[model samples]
Target: MTHMSMSYLSLIVVTMVIGMGASWYVNRQINKYLHVPASMRVTGAQMAEMMLAANGVHGVQVYRGGPQQDHFDPRNNSITLDPDAFGGTSITAIATACHEAGHAIQFAQGYAPMKIRGALVPAVNFASNAWVFLLMFGIFMQLSGLTTLAIVMYAVVVLFQLVTLPVEFDASRRGLAYLKTQGISQAEQGGAYSVLRACALTYVAAALTSILQLLWLLQSRDE
Candidate 1:
């Protein structure tokens, strides 16, 4: 491999290792915190209900949204929690539920960053899928113009990740801030923050990986 290719390979390997580590750690944390018997012990559902009510919000249904990739869907105005997050009393469950709720809150308040991110989702999805074909086709044919278009498309992915930074950060911030004021004990607050931060780290890692890949593409533009 050329020096640049080797550098990219090394960076990608590093990013993957770090990402997997973060995923494992965050998953462990979420599972561990899913059953903590706290002072004001309540199920995730009850807490979600209480929290929403406290904010005088209604019609935002809470559902046991299946397994694996459970998330709150704003379009439906529902907080769909995972099986554990929907029923467990763990810190992970609570924090994740609240994080989803934070998104709901953002949707309700029409947070500009969140709105912009939502708008970009469709375009990014299309670009992400088409980018590789564009790049490969350009390389095989040695078409500089096609290659440039592919690079620009790849850059959209980076832009999407960068735009995502504020959306994720604000959600975590909102969740943590709300958790602090919603009668969570100091100890629980710390644990919740840990869970949220761990989750946030995964995003940061992904963004960094995209950035490095984009830079590598830029460095290859002269080829």
Candidate 2:
């Protein structure tokens, strides 16, 4: 292989390693934070209600969504807490619920950045899931005509990831500030920071991987 090709290959490998390691590290820390609760006392649902009321934005609802994962749906004005978050009352749970609540507040207040981020969601979802296949298929067909198209599609994925960075970061910042203002849990062991930071890392890793993959795709764009 040419030196140029080899250099691109090495960069891809390095970025992938960083991306995967960041994800794994963050997940492990979130789980560890769940276990080391400064306050397992506040249930996620209860915390949601409290924060919502504190925010003075009524008519929104909080409910357990089901197993595994949890999130907020702005369109419905609902906070979806997972079984772990809703029932476990771990520090992780409370912080997570609060994070969702932050989204709700963003929606209610008509936060411009949140609106921009939300607008990108469908495109982001499509780019992340579909554009990859399209790129590979174009390559497999040896369609030089489609190479630039593929890169452009994947570039959308990278842009979406970039947009997501501010959205997730802002959510966590709002959530953490709420926790601190309310004095929800004692500062150090509160795990509020830990949970929020872990969540941030997930977004960071995702953004990094998307950018890395976009670079790889560009380098492979056929001659």
Q: Whose lDDT is greatest here? A: 1
Candidate models: Cα lDDT each: 0.80, 0.76
**1-223 per-residue lDDT for model 2 (tens digits):** 4866787778778877887888787788678767655443778888888888898988888887777568888878888888888876777887888888888888889888788878877877776677657766776897766666767877876787787777777777777777787655576335777778877887887787778767666665533
lDDT of 2 at 151: 74
Q: Write the per-residue lDDT of candidate 1 for residues 67-100, one digit (tens) a residue.
A: 7555667778888887887887778777887787
* TM-scores, each model vs. reference: 0.92, 0.84
lDDT of model 2, residue 212? 73
Error of 1 at 22 (Å): 1.8
Q: Worst ten-residue run, lDDT, model 2?
A: 181-190
